[model samples]
Target: MKNIVILISGGGSNMAAIARAAQKEAWQEKRGLRIAAVISNQADAPGLALAKNLGLSTDVLSHKSFDSREAFDAALMACIDQHAPALVVLAGFMRILTPGFVQHYAGRLINIHPSLLPAFTGLNTHQRAIDAGCRVAGATVHQVTAELDHGAILAQAAVPVLPGDTAQTLAARVLTQEHLIFPQAVRSFF
Candidate 1:
């Protein structure tokens, strides 16, 4: 079976959702896909436990231990290469990867961003969208490129910015769409 490795830095709700979808969709039997591992740069990341509970191998290569961004990327690349991942999913992974590392993974790397992308590329997307008076806020699944959050979008799901919506509320709604679309986008890769 082809292997998929996921990277995360926090609670990994999207990772959990993808794991559930893989099982429910029988991706292993049907599409020859398996979640080979879940990795994090933070040792204290709660997603490690979630991945473990899902019976996936887990690894933590703390960025603090590395001398530089390149060093961390090299170690991370090594860890990921060991699995020979057919695809690498960034599920809330919070690091700005080196360009070399991004090139190494190239077309096989993908990420889910909180905004429609090309709009709010970096952080604080929800609040930025709210402040900009956007009527719709959404998520984008895109091929990972050296440029931050700028890549060929594979899929997107839009949610209306309801009246009186706070950033937290907007984030919550957008996250729901993220859960749905991420798994679908991953499946489409095969």
Candidate 2:
């Protein structure tokens, strides 16, 4: 089986979606994929409990405990290496990794971002889309690169920005798409 290690910093909605997919018999028989471990940068993150509930191995590598981003990434990489993951999926992982770490993972790492990247690269994506009066807002699943939200696109799901949509409403609509596409992207990796 192809082992996958997923990293998360928050609620891990995407991680849950992918794990659910990995549990399917057809997915396992056809893709030969399994979620081996879940690594979180915050010990208190709600995702950790969710992972445990799913019976997956989990770890916490709090960034605040480390002296530098390099230190955190190095330790994180060490934990990940133990799993011998064929693929690493960053699902709501909030850390900005150093170029060296990104390079080390290279094609093995992938991420799901909240917005159509290059358009809205960082946080507050839903508010930004609303402020810009964008007709469309969506999510992108892509290879993780050294640069933030700059990577090779794998798949995207777009949600139309309705006329009456608030940032919260738009975000809710987009999140649904995120859950769908994120799992599909991970499945593609295998």
Candidate 3:
């Protein structure tokens, strides 16, 4: 089976979705793939508890404990490599990885972003999209690159921004889309 390791910094809805999808017979029997671990940067992240409840191995390597981003990433990579993951999924892993870290998992790493990408590449995407009067907003599943969200797009799901939509409303809509597409993209990789 192809083992996957998911990195998260918050509630891992996307990670859970992908795990559930992989559990299906179509994926487990037809394609040999599995979620091996869920690692978080924050020890108290609620997702760690969820992952434990689902019987998945979990780890928390606090960024504060490391001397540098490089040190933290090195430790993170070591923790992930212990499982020998065939792929690493970033499901809200908020930290910016160093170039060397990104290179180590090149082509085998993927991430889900709240914006359609190449439009709003960084934080505050929902507010920015609404402020810019974008009629349509969406989520993107892409390969993680050294250039942040500037990666090869694998998939996207567009959601309409209503005239009265607030950032919270927009975010909620986009999150639903994210949960759907992220799992599909992971399945495609398998």
Query: What's each prediction's TM-score?
Result: 0.99, 0.96, 0.97
Kindly provide the TM-score of model 2 when superposed on the true structure, using C-alpha atoms: 0.96
Highest TM-score model number: 1
Ranking by TM-score: 1, 3, 2
lDDT of 3 by residue, 1-190 (tens): 7888999999988887777777654565788777889999999988898888777889899999999999999999999999898999999999999998899999999999999998899999999999999999999999999998988999999999999999999999999999899999988876
Off by over 4 Å in 1: none
Q: By lDDT, who's the top model here? A: 1
Winner of 1 and 3 under TM-score: 1
Writing each residue's lDDT as its tens digit, candidate 2 over 17-126 gives 98887786456577777888999999999999999998889999889988999998899999999999899999999988899889889999999988987789989999
Instruction: Give the per-residue lDDT of model 1 (tens digit) for 1-190.
Output: 9999999999989999999999999999999999999999999999999999989899999999988999999999999999999999999999998999999999899999999988999999999999999999999999999999998999999999999999999999999999999999999998
Candidate 3, which segments miss by more than 4 Å at Cα? none
